[model samples]
Target chain A: MYWITVLVVAIMILSALAVLLLPNLLAAVAASSVVSLALSVVFVIIRAPDVAMTEAAVGAGLSGVILVLALRRLGLWGLGDDNHPRPGDSLQGSGDDA
Target chain B: MRNFTSLLFAGGLGFFLLVLAADLPVGAAPMVAGEGILGQGPEAVGAANLVTAVVLAYRGIDTLGELSILFAAAAGVGLILSGMRRRADQRPDPEGGFILLAAADLLFPLLVIVGLYIVLHGHLTPGGGFQGGVILAAAFFLPLLGRPGDSLNHAVVNWVEGLAGGAFVLIGLWALAVKGDFLAPMLGKGALGSLFSAGTLPLLYIAVGLKVGAEIAGLMSTLQETEAAEP
Candidate 1:
C-alpha cells in the first residue's frame, strides 16, 4: 500500500514536470493528462472514489480533448510550424530589441 | 535565476503544506464523528450514498450554481465558434475505415446503457450524474470520431437541455410548495439499499445527468463543426 502511494505520487510529480518541460503543446497536453490520471490514482488510494472518477473523466479525458481541439484551432499540430510562433518565441525577440 | 526562484518557492510551499498536513488526522477525524452532513445525511436525506445526499440534498443550491456555470461555459464556446466564417474552399473531412465505423456502431448502444445505468443508480452507487453525463457525451461524440462530417441533432440536444433544466427547477418549486424549503425531497424515503429509495435524489441526479450530457454533447458538436469548417 505504501509503495503504491509512493509510486503514484512520484508519477504525478514527474508528469506535472513533463507538462512544464515538454516543448510541443500537444505533448504538454498529453503530459498534463498523465498528471491528471496519476492524481486520480492517488485519489483512489486515499479512498475518494467519486473525486477519482471525476478527475479521470473531466481532468484527463474532457480537458485533454478540449485542449487538443484548441491547439488544432490554433493550427499547432506539430512543433516545427513557422506559420504559428509559440507563445514565448516572440517574447525572446522583444527582450533582445529592448 | 527565474527557475531557481520558482524551485525555491515551490519547495518552501511544499514544506509548509507538509508541516500543516502532519498536524491533521489521517482519515475520518474523531471530532467530526456524528456531526454535520456525514452524521445526518443517510437518515435525513435517506440516500445510500452519503456523497449523493450531500450534493443533491444538503448543498443543492451549490449544485444549481455549478450547473449554471457549465451552461454559461457551453454558451460561450458556442458563441465563439459560431462567429467564425467557414471558407468555401475547405475540403470535407475523411471518414473512418470499416472496422472503426463498425466498432462505433456496436459500442454506441452499450455505452448509452452504461451511462444511463450509472446516472440512474447514482444514489445507490459511487457513480453520479457528472461522471455518467460525461460518459454519455463521449458515447454521442464517438460517432464523430468515425465520421467527422456526421453531426448530432442540435434541436434534440437543446430540447433535452431545456426540459431537464425545467424539470430540475419545477421539482425544487414543488419541494418549496410541499416542505416549505427549496429542493426538499418530496417522495417518501423507501427501504435503504433498494433502487427505489432516496426520495427525490435519484430524480434530481437523472435531471442533472440529462442536462449535463446535452450541454457537453452540444459543446463537442459545435467544436467539431468548427474544426470541420475551413479556416
Candidate 2:
C-alpha cells in the first residue's frame, strides 16, 4: 500500500511537471489529464473516494475535453511547433492573439 | 539571479513546511469534529456513507452555496458569450469522424445509466451529485461533439437548470418550515443505505445532480458554439 502510494505520487508529480514543461499545448493538456488521473488515485489511497471521483470526472475527463475544444476553437490544435502557426491551417482564419 | 533567488525562497518555504509537519502526529489525524461526526452522524442523518451525511445534512447550506456559484458561472458564461455564436447558415465544425461518432453513440446510454446510478445512490456510495452530474453533462455533450451541426436546445437547458435550482431552494424552505432550520434532514431517514433512506438528503442530491448537469451541459455547448463566431 505504501509502495503504491509512492508510485502514484511519483507519477502525479512527473505528469504535473510534464504539463508545464511540454511545448505542445495538446500534449500538455493530455499530461494534465494524467496528473489528474494520478491525483484521483492518490485521493483513493488516502480514502477520500468522493474527492477521487470528482477529480477523475472533472479534472481528467471534462476539463480535458473543454480545454481541447477551446484549443480547437482557437485553432491551436495542431501537431506542429508551439511558436509558429501554419498558414491556412487555422480554422478560425487567424492565430489566437486575443 | 532572480530565478535562483525565487527557487531558493520556494525551497526554504518547502523546508519550513516539512519541518513543521515532522513535529505533528504521524498516524493519528486529530479529528476532533470527525470523531464527533463518526460517533453521532449516523444517528443524526442515518446515511450509510458518512461523507454524504456530512455533505448533505451538516454542510447543506454550503452545498446550496456551491450550486448558486455554478448557476452564476453558467449564467455569466451565457451573458459573456451571448452574441458570439455563429449564425445558422455558417458551417460549424464537421462531424468528429467515424470513430468519435461510433464511440459517442455507444457511450451515451452507458454514461447516462452510470451517472444516474451514481447520483441516486449517493447516500450509499462514495460518489454524489456533483461527480455524477459532470458525467451526465459529458454524456449529453458527446453527441454534440460527434455532430456539431445538431445544436443543443438552449431554451430547454435554461429551464432545467432554473427548475433544478428552484427545487433545491424549495426543498430547503420546506425543511425550514417544518423543522425551523433550513435543510435539516427530515422525511424520516427510512433505512440506512436504502434507496429511500437519508431523509431529505437524497432529494437534495437529486436536485444538485440535475442543476449541475444542466449547468455543465449549457456551459460546454456554449463553448462549442463559440467556435465559428471567433472575431
> Model 2 lDDT vs. the true structure?
0.89
Worst 10 residues of 2 chain A by lDDT: A79-88
lDDT of 2 by residue, A52-91 (tens): 9999999999999999988977878742444554332464
Candidate 2 on B1-231: residue-level lDDT in tens? 998999899899999999999999999868988899999998899899899898888889998888888889888988988888777877677556567889999999999999999999999988989998999999999999988888789899889888988988899999999999999999897887788998888888988998999999999999989844243
Interface RMSD over true interface Cα atoms for each candidate: 7.2, 4.7
Candidate 2 chain B, poorest ten consecutive residues by summed lDDT: B222-231
DockQ of every predicted complex: 0.19, 0.36
Local accuracy of candidate 1 as per-residue lDDT tens digits, B1-231: 999999999999999999999999887576553377776777788888888887898889899999999999999988988876234565334566677789999999998998999999999988889999998998998898778777889999999998998889889999999999999976999998899998999999999999999999999888767744223
Candidate 1 segments whose C-alpha is farther than 4 A from its true place: A78-98, B1-34, B85-89, B227-231
Off by over 4 Å in 2: A79-98, B228-231
Best by DockQ: 2
